[model samples]
Target: MRRIVNITILLYVLFGVSMYIYFFTGSDIGIPVEYKGTSADPTTFMNARELVLSEEYSSVKNFLFFLGTPFEWIVLFLFMVLGVSSKFEQWAKAITSKRFVQFFIYFFYFSISMFLLIFPFRFVSYQLSKAYHISVQSFSSWMKDMTIDFWVNFIMMFVAMHVLLLLMKKSKRRWWIYAWCMTVPLTLFLTFVQPVLLDPLYHEFRPLQNKQLEERILEMAEKADIPANHVYEVNMSEKTTALNAYVTGIGSNSRIVLWDTTLEKLGENEVLFIMAHEMAHYVKKHIYWGIGLGLGVSLVGFFVVYKLVSFIQRRFGKMMRVEGKGSFAVIPLLLLLFSLFSFVISPFTNYVSRYEERQADTYAIEMTKDNESAVKAFQTLAKTGLNEVDPPMLVKIFRHTHPAIVERILFLESYDGKIDR
Candidate 1:
């Protein structure tokens, strides 16, 4: 029995290390390319914008899109099989009898599962882009991106998981109340403070100084019913050519950030259209809705984790290993199991996001009355970003946030007679 458990642990570690090696080694190989554009080109600019707004790229990105699905199934299968297996159940009963063993086992599985599942996607992205001559062929650049993302995401995941676990242990029956209390304040802080405060740790942001463009943008904001005082341009070109703009912060900190590349590449009308879409997000209170949705999801996630953990503890308390005094090595395993459980729930979350995105699009079209500009902007974005012209329907349903560019254009075409609102 001990031998079997030890072998399972070894297999888990081996699989994790193999995946990590595949990612790092693949990313070390670079693709060489000479970019034709010295500054952000209009075509490139438009392509970038379109890529963000399109569901077309999901074909290639499907590896990641469907990655979690299999993992979730595997987890469910493992848990159920183990639960029913007389040998494993006897071992778990023995192990879970010790609190330290139970905790360590859950923690170990959680950490390893998360690391294995998520780490390879970064490598996949790096290799795919290099293959297509989209990304620079530099190990340092790849490492930089990987490291920055790892640290930021690691902190967020760690806090969320630990807090959830603590809450579950504390309240038992009323855990939801405690979880909600902890979640709401943290969500608000992350939304309002992190963008301005913590985000700069990973990327530099500087004020954009195109006086002419800034003035025009401010005027446009005023016309759109968004306060001119809330608009700012930031120099995001210092990073990569991946053009992006976002409306972040709440209340006084709330502002519109136009990436330098976006400002340089887009025409006045296109920029206005983009800004109008962002404004629509604010006007429709999408941020608050997002916060509420996150809380709801977390609540569901807590119940799932709690029930699963309790079941495991009740069934297999004795057979798990004790690594140290009062330490059970199963904590990671539990975390992994919980993550897998959460992955199963991801499709529902994605559905909610897609709905919100559609709502924002409707608001943008209605408010801007410039459906033509929106369509052109999306096309240019798709081209510049080298996004796939069309993605498979399954990919779009599972992974995409925005509607397909072609779909958006067609929708706009149907409204040709309308004036710019």
Candidate 2:
């Protein structure tokens, strides 16, 4: 029975590694190119922009994205089957009989596994950035950044996991109630505090120092009916050359973060357009909508896991390998299964996100009254991010968070007249 468990673990690890290698190596992934002159074919240029901005490559990336769902399902199915077996039940009974021992074993294993997986990826990703000449920081600097990030996230995860365990013990319907209660608060905290508290751990943040630009942004915010205090800038140039920006938080705490790299690369008009787009998200209340959608999806995922686990236990209770009864070692296995189920729903989530992004883009056009800057900003962003010029369609559906750049440009071009503020 122990050997069988070991075999299962080995197989799972191998499968994961295989998938990673296949996706990382098989895709013709490369950094975005600098945009050249009018001599470039318009259709080709647009396609290239779309590919870069969308981060799509050949069909390989899309295939891997799609493949994630089934792979997760397989893992979940195996866990469900193994968890309910007589042998696993016995093991669970023993572990639950000593709660401290059970907790320590699972917690330690989880922590170690997460660290091993995440830390190396951080190092490798940094190396890749350096190789591409996109990195702005040295290895030592990157390591310092990683250390700060690790501690912040590690502490948060520790607190959250313990809280979840507490909730799991108290709830009558463990998965559903836990999911519902945790989702709202977790989403809110991550959206709000993450930018203000967590982000500063990795990069320095300062107020927008360009008084003229700042004033213009505030004016735009007032015109757009978004609060002025939410606009700020972060010194992201110390970390990487990749241009980026985001809107986060909610209500009074909500704010816009403009990467210094973006501010440096884009003209004032382009920056204003980007700021307008972010403000649109806040004014339109997309943050709250997104959180609500996330909660709903999480609830559905929890229910699916609960039902599936129950079914497995009922169907094959005697065959399970574990010794004892009513063990909760099965919980992690259930989580693994749920993760797989959630991956299946990722496309829907991406679609919803893309829709919200499009709305924000429209708002930017209206506010800026200049589709040209918006187009230029996207092109510049693509170049900064080393985006592929044209990714396959399947890649777009599975992986893209925003509409392809070409699609966005075409949409803007379709406007019949000057956009009204």
User: Per-prediction TM-score, please?
Assistant: 0.70, 0.76
lDDT of 2 by residue, 1-421 (tens): 5676677667766876765655555554432343233212133444655544345333333444454444444444454455532334355346676764555455545444445544544565566666565677887887787667666765665565555555545663674566567677778878878766777777677778888899899998888777666467888787688787888777666778898889899999999889988988888889889888988888888788767756655665445422123354454455566677766787899999999998898888877888778778877765666554344445566678888765676566555455452
Model 1: per-residue Cα lDDT over 1-421, one tens digit each:
5465466557656655554444333222111123223112223344455544333233345544455345444443344334322333245446677654544345445444555665576678767666554555476866776667766766676566556656656666666467667877888888899668876765656565766656766676676677656456665555445556777888767767777677777787877778777877777787788788888887777677657655665666544331222222333445556567566676777777777766666666776778667767766665655654434555455556676554555566455445342
